[model samples]
Target chain A: MSEFARLEEKLAKLRQRERIAGEGRKLRGKGGDALLAALVAEIDETILPRRLSLVTPQGPVHLAVANRRLQALLAPVPGSLPEGLADHALPDIEDPKLAELGQSLKTLLAEAENIPVTARRLDRAFGSDIGVPAVQLPRIWTVAQPTAAKPDDILSGFLADLGDAALAWLRIEGEEVTLQGGEEAAVAALSEQAAIFLDSYFGKFDAAYREPSLACGTVIAPADGSANAVFFVEIGEFSAIIHAPAAQMPSIASDWQRRVAE
Target chain B: MDITAELDAMRVDVQGCALVAYTDLSSQLVLSTSAAANPVQEEMNALSQAAHLALDGAIAEGAAVSWGGETPAELAFLMTGAEVRLFLRSPANSSEALIAVCAPDVDLERAVSEARATLARIGGQG
Candidate 1:
């Protein structure tokens, strides 16, 4: 059966209880220890609202099931969950449905960030040691193919480690978020070329954007698959280039899709 | 390769695809298209133009024509939480490209690889 179908069957069985899928509002239900357990078992972290709270004899019991192994979101409250007939806040489930919740992904695009910029390839290299100044632009690309050296391990396991070291100190002033570093200006300056590319190829996208959601740096295949590139997304307000192991893209992509739905 | 055959196969080849088009970027027009749902003409034109600029425009001038370094300049693909667009520019005719639309959950690597292969053969008249 389709994943959605399975989830549907599980939810249907619990229809006896109120299902509050959206928020604040409470959805009620009646008696089904096995049903609740079954529903949690099938839908892993791939789907959100994966956690549902049951109003029980003890109080509101939160059920957080992930990776098919019940984690802290575990419930039953040790005899607190009296013989079923409890309320569940199932907001956004009826209106959007589990299938409708996100763009529905089948890729490994784990995390995506929409950093402010006109957009330029800022290939920074950080020294393994802390307090070391990270090189902002590592490679020197020529106007024509002059055999310039660009790192082939582009961004692989690198972004995850960058937070270990800090190139620019962060401070907050009133409502303004500030990064203390001249590198910010350099990255912005590099956007001039990127701006040109954005205007020429990927047209600006106007959406319900919280921040800049236009522009993407591109990379074509037939290479070693190590070089990083960006995709100018045509949907929603998000604009980011995803970097992750190709194999894990689907689950990660689905996670991103869920966020968009939110 | 049969363009229609290739486009039709995308239904099974790539999950969640809505439409596929073979576009002549020189004119930013669609030569042919295949999809379960028909999008408006304006959408197709926009996609065509986007494909043209991505591969043939000024940004392409860098890295001496191929997509910089060892990367091939045959394909450009992006997926969003909203829509997924994949463009493959034919090496035979720089202006020719394939535009594909799919849902966010699609296997993007497969989409690009399949589209790139089709564009490559489009010139050979396979």
Candidate 2:
């Protein structure tokens, strides 16, 4: 094949791989013991009235599964865990379903453990660290060149195209409610927006999952941390935006990494 | 916090991340590093500067160049057949960056993100 043809083929393969990644995201979204889905479900469960609670002198101490999962997630590194929350919250699992769930949780935790190793391996194969940064490449004229569009440009255009259909935002000032624009209006929303934007921009190649959703808006909770929430609006199978309080940012970032691991 | 300790925290999450070095942008001197015996400090800084300069040029041209490319310019490939190296620009200072050298199959995205996180923690701009 000609050099141009070879480059075209490589670009096509990359686009195809990106499409496959989108499909994989949908699969994970459907059901998996992977950290994000499980954590989200657990957090959602926490918001609901308790089905299981243990009565104590203090009060009816509700079972916090999210806390347990967090504990389990950090179990491998107990020393790193903050004090007061180090001890295991539950005694043990007796029920078979609960036991199986515990095993699944272990599996997810193991995957989290492998994140660093997997990242290193992928970096080597990708050799993103070894070559001249593409930004520095001499502009070579090509008969079949990939478009020079940056990922952000593509995302901005995509968000712009949404027009009135753009996602709406909610601003929560302390306990007060306010309306703001959606993910597009988020201050310092670049990295968060980039995630969904990349998924949608690439999803165009895989028409099966090409709809995009922007963040609904910020849902502010009182500083007490009782009613805080993270909202996700799925534009389609491919793109979605998550809105959460600033305090939850680290956990959310961890969840994103877990999804990437999956 | 010491740069080595910060890199260690990040290195634990990435398996093939062999070395993490912080270089002074102007002097091209390695301020701190995770490797026991880092021999290629000068080369890494030189290549990293080239990559960083290129990225800045792209940004100047309004080419929205985030670090998510199939082949980011920040990566260095040694023609002498050495391990792959990645250079991450500090978000705090344009001149300084955190360099990571890894095996060929390392997870580029997550590793880079972890390094970026560490950089952010150490008050470096990445």
Candidate 3:
């Protein structure tokens, strides 16, 4: 065949490849939409209504009560009330246990609301995965107006403060932290810690009008022969450690600095 | 001097010349080339509406406008990406519309220029 014919053939193959890839992407997008639909349905049928009942003034409030119990079970060590609920009227119920549960649920929800922000702050401060659990960690963040200082200055200050706690946890957990995917036990422990940290953090920012921000990061273990835990700080950026062993801490302090500079 | 004849000659120069009409503030095709009905006409109608919307305030005094080198109008053109299907309305009148279905990659600036020149020839200045 002539050189032109060969080039044409190659172009045709490239086009075919692109078409296939496009189709694959479409299929994946459809699958994702289906999954999202299912999740929405589940939330509607179960979680959402339960959450609404707790917020509503008049109803059976059964889920609200149950939520409180779940909150208590999930509380961090030396637990306290979530910032938002500290001033809200509690359920005027007779059962001491039930009342306690309501308070705990309120606290948990408040804490849950702050996890993402706290996780991001921690990731920025000490380093990503320094104290992260081996599971799908979802972060809930709220945007704050830049303080009197410049935006970068405020972010730097926040990172500095968060570094202290993140480092402490990292030191304590040290080598014992194993890689795992969706490990309920590990996630439960991380969630407890996250709740405590977030509750305190939210309290500090309670004066401002807050919005919900949820971000999820996946923890990949070396046992599974995967790269370091992939921490998506926000929706668009990924923090990955290429060479680090999953068993060891990924050095992210420098990486954080590089990213901020960029 | 029949400006309509001059505009028709220009359209023929570009080949496959179809109905080229100049619309007034009322959107009535004041002057147009005698062309058969086709998808291009429908596209032009849409473009007219869009142009009117975009040039809403500018049309009163009449501003030079043009758009072309798009699908259903231009031949030997490559499909760029997405097709442009809409109307163009000169600011002269909300009703005055220039519509065209153009190739996605049509030279918008050129089309706008041609349109304005055509309007000028027809004594419509915007």
What is the alpha-carbon interface RMSD for each candidate?
6.2, 15.6, 26.3
TM-score of chain B of each: 0.78, 0.65, 0.42
* DockQ scores for all predicted structures: 0.18, 0.01, 0.00
Best by TM-score: 1
CAPRI grade, predicted model 1: incorrect
> Can you tell me the CAPRI class of model 2?
incorrect
* Count: clashes, candidate 2: 43
Q: After superposition, which runs of candidate 3 have C-alpha atoms over 4 Å from their true positions?
A: A1-262, B1-7, B10-20, B25-48, B57-82, B85-100, B124-126
Model 3 lDDT tens row, A166-215: 32111111112222223344333332333232222223221111222111
- Give the number of the best model, judged by lDDT: 1
Per-residue lDDT of candidate 2, residues B43-121 (tens digit): 5555445334323322111112121222222322111012335556676665676777665446555665687688788
TM-score of chain B of 2: 0.65
The digit string of per-residue lDDT tens for model 1 on A133-232 reads: 1111011100111121111111222223323222221111111222222245432322222233334333222211112221122333322333323222
True-contact fraction per candidate equals 0.20, 0.00, 0.00
- Sort order, lDDT high to low: 1, 2, 3
The regions of model 1 sitting more than 4 angstroms off are A1-262, B58-73
